[model samples]
Every structure is written in structure tokens, then in C-alpha cells.
Target: MAPSPSSAAQHRHHSSLPTVSSAVSWLFLSLLFLYVVYYSTILFEPAPTFTTTTTTKTATDCQDISTIESNTTRVLRFDTELRHIAFGIAASSRLWRIRKEYLKLWWRRGETRGAVWLDKEVTTTENENLPDIHLSEDTSKFSYTNPNGDRSAIRISRVVSETLRLGMEDVRWFVMGDDDTIFIVENLVRILSKYDHNQFYYIGMTSESHFQNMLFSYGMAFGGGGFAISYPLAVELERMQDRCLQRYPGYYGSDDRMHACMAELNVPLTKEPGFHQNDVHGNLLGLLVAHPVTPLVSLHHLDVVDPIFPGMPRVQSIKHLLESAKYDSASIIQQSICYDKKREWSILVSYGFAIQIVRGILSPRELESPARTFLNWHKRLDYTAYAFNTRPVTRNPCQKPFVYYMSSTEYDKTREKIIGIYTLHRERYPYCKWKMESPEDIDTIVVLKKEDSSRWTKAPRKDCCRVLPATKNGTLYLWIGNCQTNEVIEL
Candidate 1:
């Protein structure tokens, strides 16, 4: 126990040499093991797979788990380009002339891909500014028992599988819609970009009417509004959908058929409010004015709804609305509420759509709900038919909104922002009995907004706005954008 200091130091030195030697030996072994692993991988690894959307490769086929895992990483849904999607539009030869006009509105001849599945064949010329046309496979074997439903549902339901069978190269998502469906392609791409193509996602929205959702599963994605299926999901659906269809022969429409098959696969719906089924008919003002704070992806049942801009042809009005979307689809019809403290007035701007000027200041909460300007799909059903919240139109003429539909939108080079100019819709509202000041004399409302797509991927909030009121003639100027820090909307 009482050793000399020199002796104790010598013992410590002896023990440290073995410790150092053992570490060096282990380090050498680790390096050697790593070297072997690296070389073995290089020598035995299978060449990387180059898969087209049609490739039949499976993870089970490969014994090299490391390579399989590495290859699967390439299948994620990020940075998806427009070329990666394929559209399956259900059409009929009888209505081809009219429906093709709708297709021409947004169909990019070379840039967009996929075909229109028609009930019968139609000849196409090189100059046809539309997608290729294909005849749907005869669905005589399928049964539809709904007394009011058409057998065409069977044909339309098969469009997705037939489209997938076409084996489009590099297709990440398969989008399905009706002949009359108007798709905003850029917004569709943006909406799909949020999902993972490697996983199964049935993305779309249900009907605007509660009765439709009640009859059909609330979880169903109405095909008329358009729904997207991931490539993997499409492949899985293609396998069992035909057999699955047999079990649901009584389905009312194509959407329910697809929904039933999706249910069989256990893939729940991924609802995107922007994909509007628009089951209601009549003026679309109330709905578009208070659209959910999301990109305008698609609009359905446009034929039944009145022209978006009063007095203009239905087609022309839609084209007019699209002018603003062309510049900024992400913010199209997005609602922004602002107040005029001086005038004690409330103004709501639905960019690229319409501007609402109320006679008196109204709370933002009340303005957020869409006014019951549109009738329910079934006229017998009252305001309660809407699946979403709605407010009844006021019998008081003073409270009625002085609406101005967007006449045009243009980018101001000097201002560095796109400006939307809305003009008064000439239909005279019930004369106001109240003795308060009104926007009746104001002929124009000009709104300025800078476009940014990234705002959608972040938290969803209504864009903040201020009433500039710097008017020239009868014009009112306002600017809307991301809110400033601690910005509050108040009187």
C-alpha cells in the first residue's frame, strides 16, 4: 500500500501501453470491416433502376434490400413537374362539340398529357387543340340498379383503369374528371405537389349539397369536381377495381364506384376544398366570394351556374375570371376583408373574382359565411341543404351587397403588382330605404396584390388588406398581401 512515487508511476505507464495497443487494434479492425463492406456493395449492388410509370418492378423481386431501399427513395412526390400527371376526362360523342369547347379553355396541347375517354370514337386532326381521344371499353356486363342513374356511370368509372393501362411514361398522378370539368392545371399541379406519390391518396372534395353527401358516402371524392390518384394507388386500384366493381353494381354514379373500390383498398379520402363539386345552381357569387383560403384547383357544373360576370356569355365570363388566375392561381378568388374607417364602410375583395361593398360596417365573422345567393341542387331543400355554413340573404335592401365583378386584371409594371379592376354589375338591387351613405355611386374598385405560391404551403390565413381610398374619378384603390406584424383588422 505504501509504494514509492516512482514505482507507482512505472505501474501506471505499464497499464496505459496495453490500453493504447488494444484501441489501435480495434480501430484497424473497424477500418478493415468498413473497407470490405464498401467493396462488397460496389461489386454486388444491382445497377440502379430506370423505371417508367409502367414498370412492373417490385421490391420483393430484389434480394439486395439495401439497393431496394435506395431505389424506393426515388419514388417520393417532391418537385413534381406538370408532365408527371395524366388526365382521364369522361366525355361523350353526343355532346362532343360543346364539351370540347370547355376542354379547349385549359388544355395545353403539347404541355398537358392524357386522353379524353369518349363513349364512341371520334376522328382527331393534328390541329385539334385537345388531348387525344379514346373509346371507353364496353361496360355491358356491369349493372346499375339506381332507378334514376344512368349506365354511363359504369363506363366513366372504368376510365381511370383504362387510362392507367395506357402506360403513360413518368406519370406520378392520375387525375379524373368529367367532360365539362374546368381544370386550372397550374393549381392542380400545386395541389398534387403537397402529396406523396409513393403513397396511396384519393384526393378531392365531396358535393356542396348535404343531400348528395348523405346519399353518397361523405368520404367520397366527387369525380365531377376531379380527383387525383397517386401512381402507386392507381396501379393497386387497376388490379382489384374490376372485381370490386361487381360488388357495387347498384352505385349511383362513377364516383361512388371509384369510392367503393377505394374503400376496398382502405384508402381514405384526402379532401381539398379547392376542388369544388359546386352542387348548387344559380349565381356562384356567394360561394366564390367566400372561397376557402386555398388555391382554386378545379370547378365543376359550370354549365348550370349563371355566368360568373353578369350579362357576359357563360364561357366568356369564365375566361374573364381566368385572366387573373393566369397571373396568380394560388390567390384566385381568395377573400380579403378591409374596412373604411372614414366612410364607416366594409369592403371585401375576392381577388380575380368580385368586390363586395356593404352599406355599413360588418363583422368579419359574418362576412366569412357565403350568402345564400345560390339555390340548392333540389329547390325543395332549403338553405340547410348546403354542407357548409351559409347566411340568408337580408330582406333589408340597405344590407344587400353592392357587387362588382372583375372586368379585367393586368400587371402594372410601375407598381410591380398585378391589379384587378372590378366594375359594377348593372343589375339594380332592391332600392335601399336606409338613409346611410352607400357605394352606389362608386363605379370601380381597383385591387392590387402581389402573387406568391409559397403562401399555400404555409399556414392558411386570409390575406390582409387596407382601403387606400385614393380615388380618381369614382374608382377605389386598395392593396392586399401578407399581413404586417401584429396587424389587426378593426374599425
Candidate 2:
């Protein structure tokens, strides 16, 4: 049958619309493919120039970010001073995703806070290809046969050594950390303030296993898994690179050997609380240096350890935990909502009852049977559960336009209460939605807050029952309800 225009429009609206779910899935697939390709190439490459020579190089060559050098000095300096530093990340083709993920902690587009990322460039040349050699991530045939991770260390060292040679100047200090390691940037600057007392300093987590190298009840950072040094310290460290590499051949899997090189050159090492490569959960607060995330640098054989906030996908989860601790025994700040960890969300259906459910108000009977069935079904049906889940697969949200904008309409001028079961409201409950004409609505229109991760904050201020700006370009679904009548109007 030839459908009516209104019926056809409605059917098209519901059937032909694209969803946020589809976009997110597409992005995840694309990145996964890139990551797979990168790692596969790195696993099976032949050994490089420094690998065959023993005692000529240290095992420090094997670790990623080993190519610390000074060639980037011209490109890094801004405003004629070394205010910003650029990290030249070398993600062996296999581990580029890991590198990308790790680097994201420091850099994200549109965020001009601190530091900048000069777009990543991969090494294309082969092993034994001198300064310009590239590393791949296909670790299918990797081994620990040589205690010194020769080939890997040499590749990483060449890149990092060159980066230091370029990026650093007479700035306060230059930090060298791993992609997996989470650095407390503010704390590092604090430690840098004290560099005058000691110029050529090597800072990192001390190794308890290598306790033989201690001095004055402690030794400086045992390795360079992750650490920092001043400009003079940087220069001094650079001078020892060749001799250190020559003596150890390739310090495969050994980052601290660079520290050992610094120690060999009489560069004094100081043990501070923050500069750590180990999981010091309790000590994170006061420490001057530490890897808050994984790939715990400065210390080897500790990469497999887990972060304190277990299973947390976002940094906010960790911060919330710390905040909960910080206010312990103090005034308790209540979160607006508490979500179930295992199950994503719950729907509570009340059958046309009381307007308010307050401390003394009448309570409505919830549909316990339907709720139970829905939860059980969600648990049992893996595919449906996954589709409904709200966890973000990609870290970069705005980069990939996976999620669509919500439809918004101005509240009726005569209404005493804003009662609507909006899809936006369902996803982001307690979101402040206010009308511009209502003088009393000032409280409802929340001010843009710092660190607020809500998207509704940017919702334009409107007068009449106007549709939100972005919704006009695509499909918009909204569920409006009347509080007094106990009826829902789905649009």
C-alpha cells in the first residue's frame, strides 16, 4: 500500500537512522587493525648493528624510547626558550598502539594544557641501519636468551638519545619516561625546582633486587626505565652514550644500565619518593616522581604488575577513589548517582502513583518482576548485553563522531514542573535542563563547571519549544511525560 507522508516520514525516522553504537564499533575495529599490523612486524625482525658486539654496548638498547639525543633542540624550543618538550615516540610497528595509548595520557588534540605532540613518525629502515633504523612489534619469535636485550635496546636507544640531543636546552630539567608509565607532571616540576643543589642528577625508582649498588643507605635510580635529568645532566649523560653502548653491546631489556652509565660518569644519583618504577600505592601522594600507570619504567622485570585502580578504563575512576580517601573522616561529599559495576544501568517503573518520593512521601511499588527478568536476560544474552553496555572502547571521543547529539526542546512556559522521560535524561540523569524565560529556572541552568564531563552543559539557552541545534540535521527521539496525568508522550 502507498503509505501516507506522515506515516512514511515516521517510519523512515525510526528505521533509517544511524546510531552511536555503530560509530564506536567502527572506530574500535579500525584502531584494532592498525595495532595488529604494528605488532606483527616487530616480532620477527633480524638483529641490528649493535647486537653482535658484546661489551661494546649495554642491554639498555632493547627498551623502547632508548634513542635519547639532542637533534630536536631547534624544533622543540618555543618563544626562543625551552618552555615545551616534544617526545619522539618510537612504537615498534607491533606496539605502536600501546605507544599511542600511552602517549595519549600526555597529549590529546584540542587540549592545549601542557606539552605538545609533534606527529609520530615510524622508523622504516632495518636493524644494523645505524641512526635511522626502525623497530617493529612482531614479538612472535622474541626471546630472553641473551640477558642483555641487545637488538631491542640499540633500536630504542638511538631514537631517545637523538631526541634528548635535540629537545633539551638550559631548561629546568628534561624528563625521560616510558609510554606505559603514568607520570605525575606537576610533581616532576616540583622535583626539578631543586636541581640547583645537584646539576647532573639521575632520578628514578630504586631497584631492591640490585641492592649491591647502594650508597649512603641508598643508591641513585638503578636504571633508566624512567627518570629525569637537568640540561647539564643531559649533556653529561649524552657524553657517556657511546662508551656505555660499546661496553655493553646491547643492554637488551635493561633501561637502568643508562643510569649505571651516569653513575660510571660520576653523575650523582638521588633517591626521591616520586621517581619510582614500582607500584608504591601508599607512597603516591607525597612522592616527587613515580610511574602512576603501567610499563613501570626505571625498574625492569616489573611490567606485569597492575595499577591500583583495578579494571578502571578511565582516569576519573582512579581520581574518585583517591577523593573518597582524601575526604575520609571528613565531610562526606555524596555523588548524585551510584552505578552498578557489573550491570550498566537499571530502569525503575512506577505505575502512575505519587508525584514525589521524598523522605516522608508515599512510596510507589516498583515492577520487581519485569526488572528482575530484564536483568537476568541482560546477563544471559551476551550480544544484547554488549550492545547495551556504555563503556567507551576508544579513548578519543570527539576525534571519531560515534555518538549522535540528543534532541532538546524548550520546556512549556506554563508548566510548573519539567516532567519528561527523555532518552538524553535517561543516559545522563540529573542533567540540568532549564528554560530561558522562567526567572525561577536560573537554578536549573547549571553553570559550566571545571572538570565536568557532561555534554549537556553546552546545550544552548532557548526560549520556546525549539528543537536543540544539532538534532535538526538528523533523527531525534524524545519521550515527554506528564507528571499529573501519569502518561508518556514518545516523539
Candidate 3:
């Protein structure tokens, strides 16, 4: 089998031919596969299907969703200056505290584009940071006094006329407010957008205090809460303000005089619920939580209302609350009324602030609920006392719940008791109750004892009270049995 070298070489070459052919075939196949893949990806691949489902919604759900959609869409994109809104701030020299704390913030924000009407010119080194100051003395010559000697009427009437005259040529809207008033500028603009600026419009809301509303005309907007006047209306007011002031000599306040003037103009007051003149004193939890479905345009009497958050000053609290609205405008504007029929509990939610729980029977009238005193964060108590009333129960109030906390004076006295109550029953009873002993004092503490337990154990301060012993239908029946009578009253 010993062959020559040339023949052996020829045989080795013949054997390598098959291996070369095999490599070539594999390379050709890989190239074909790559070509097919490339073509498939580029030209033959299926287009992505974007299938949108049409949800079958209930009547209530449809309404809510529609309202939300409308609100979201209504947010317009425009420059703030395009509105030509001017602020007419009625300020006194004696209210230095307000001028320093609140006015400074407004000035820094640079939203107020008008002047502060003062009794005398303020010559200060910090004048650069302040809004325009128009001295009352300069405008007083044209002013008319009330025959009944109402100084506020005389001053406000003059100021209104002066502000209108000052802003008539340059501004489209003239906004009037007291020194203490705080305005949500964006919200105000949006609110203004709803109505035509060219037309005569007088926009405002009723006072928070029922008594004040009764004393003054409910039809008239509270000046402290702020009001907006269209250019045409302001011009009309400027022409007739002096005459109206002479006619309404018996009017008690500036608001009444303005109302009388508007009535004479045959222009009806347009109510806007967002402008809150916090005329009521005590915790604003009930009123705020049950706020009407609208944007909160302004909050007056910050001094009267408790701090919006805990461990913070009133000014800081207000600033924080206003800032919160920027993050969730839709939530702030939308109706936040929620109810749970099964538990017989009605929940009122004020976005980024407070929640109120009341009996379902008191659904719409949540403000009048016996459990209205169960404010979660009106005051900074213990972490255990603060309950997260926001739906879906995400976290404990102690764990940085999505709400503003304000300082409360009663935190020290109630902290230990609330903590102990939460620690003892948190595992067994998820719900907590706060039964207010005295209606006048919102800070008054009441200890709720468990139905079965004989010991008088304090209940968690926030989200207090639970419905007991669920029925087959999942309806909770609370029985009220009097000691003197054998009959049991069930609710």
C-alpha cells in the first residue's frame, strides 16, 4: 500500500474537498437565515395592535369619569399676564404681622400685579420687594363718608374706586382682597377662564361662618375671601361707587355696601364655592373635607383656621398647602366625596390635607356628623393617634401619609394615651374612633372603650370607632340599649 509522494498528496487534497464544501454550505445557510430574519423584521413583521377597551361603566362612574376628564382637559395653556389681572389689597398700617408674614410671601411669589392701598405711604428699605403702594391720602379727596359713620365703608368704598381707576386702562380683571387673604393664582386664572372677561361679571362665594353669612347677604361674596370683577364691571363700579356709598349709608360692612352697589347695577352675584372666607372658628377639618366640587381659589382668615400641618407655623402651612395643589391640580379640583354603603360610613376627602368619616345616613350632610370631631391631623399628637383615612389604606399616618400636618397645642397631653391605645388594639381592630366630648373645643380628647373589654382603654385618636359583628348580608347593626328600658334600638 506504499504509494508515491505525488499520489499521496493528490489523495489528501481530494479528502479536504468535502470539508471545504461542508464549510461553504454552512456559511451559505447562515447567510440565508440572516437574510430571512432581516426581511421579516423590516418588511413582513406584523404591525403592533393597539387595542383600546371600551369600559362598561355605571351611571355614577360615568358621571365621575366624565367630570374628571372635562376638568383635566379644561386646563388651558396661557401666560399669566395675558389675563391682565390686578390685585387690590386693602391693608392697614396696624396689621404689621400680616404685612410681614403673608404679604412678604405674596410679593416674593410675584403673582400680585396691583397695588396695596395703605392709610399712609410706607417708606422702608425693603420697598423693592413689595408691591406698589398707593397712599389713602392721595385717594381720600374723592372718597365719600357713610352717613351712619361706618369708617370701614368709607375706606373700602374709596379704595375700590381708586383701584378700579388705577387698573381700568391696563387690567382686564380687578381682584379685591384683605391683607390676610391668600390666593391660589393659577386656580384663580382658571376660574376666570370659565367666564368671558369682556362681559360684566362679579365672582365670589359665601362666608364659612353661617352666622356671618346670615348677618351679611349670602348673595354677596366675602371680601376677605377675595372677589373678582370684570373690567366693564369695575368701570361701572368706579362711576357709581360714590353715589352707591351715599345711598347705602346704613350698610354695616364694606361687603354689604358692595352688594348694594352691585344690586343697583342690576348685576347679580355669581357664586364660586372655591373662594373660602374662613369665617368659622375651630378645626376646619369638617368644612375642608366636605368641600364642594370646585377648585379652591382662596383661603381667608388663616389666623382663624388651625395650621394646615403639624409642627409648622400658619404661614408655612398655607404655603405648603398651596404648593401641594401644583402637584395634583386635578385631585384638588375634582369632587372627593366617597361613601361605603356596607359599613354605613361616609368618607369625605380633601386632597392633600384631611379626611372626615360620618354615618352613611348622613351622606351629603357629612359636616353635621357626630364623628366630625375625628380630625386626623388638625393637631400634631402622637404617631399612633394619626390614622390614614385615605382610601385603599396604603400606609399608617406615622409612615408619612399623603397629607399636610400642622402644629397643635394639645399634642403633649394626648400622645402617650394615643400610642398605648394604638399599640394594644392595632392588631385586632384596624379601625379607630374619636368621640368628641365637647363640640366647642375641637382639641378636647375622649377615650373610647372596646365593647367587649371591661377596662376603659383609650382608642386611637384618628380613624376611631368601628362597627361590630357583621351580619350575613355584611351590614353592621349598632344597637343602642337603654339601661332603664328593655327595648333595644338598632341602627
| Cα lDDT listed for each candidate | 0.85, 0.33, 0.54
Each prediction's RMSD to truth: 11.2, 32.2, 21.6
lDDT of 2 by residue, 301-329 (tens): 12333332223443433333323222110
Shift of residue 94 alpha carbon in model 3, Å? 0.5
Which parts of model 2 have CA positions greater than 4 angstroms off? 1-91, 108-150, 158-160, 167-170, 208-225, 250-252, 279-303, 314-491
> What are the models' TM-scores?
0.83, 0.37, 0.56
Residue by residue across 43-78, what tens digits does model 3's lDDT show? 977888864434443322102221212123222233
Model 3: how far residue 95 lies from native, Å: 0.6
Best by lDDT: 1
lDDT of 1 by residue, 1-491 (tens): 89999999999999899999999999999999999999999999999987544223342101111121222332323656678889999998988887787888888877889999998877666787899899999888876787888999998998889999998899999999988899888778778877889899999999999999999989999999999999999999999988998898787899999999998999999999999888988999999999988888898888888888888887777778777787777788899999987777889889889999987888999998999899998965497798999998877778778898888888889988998888987777777777766787789988888865556656789999998857497888899999989999996
lDDT for model 2 comes to 0.33
> How far is 42's C-alpha from truth in model 3 (Å)?
52
Query: Clashes in model 1: which pairs?
Result: none
User: Which candidate order results from sorting by TM-score in descending order?
Assistant: 1, 3, 2
- Number of backbone-clashing residue pairs for each candidate, in the order shown: 0, 71, 11
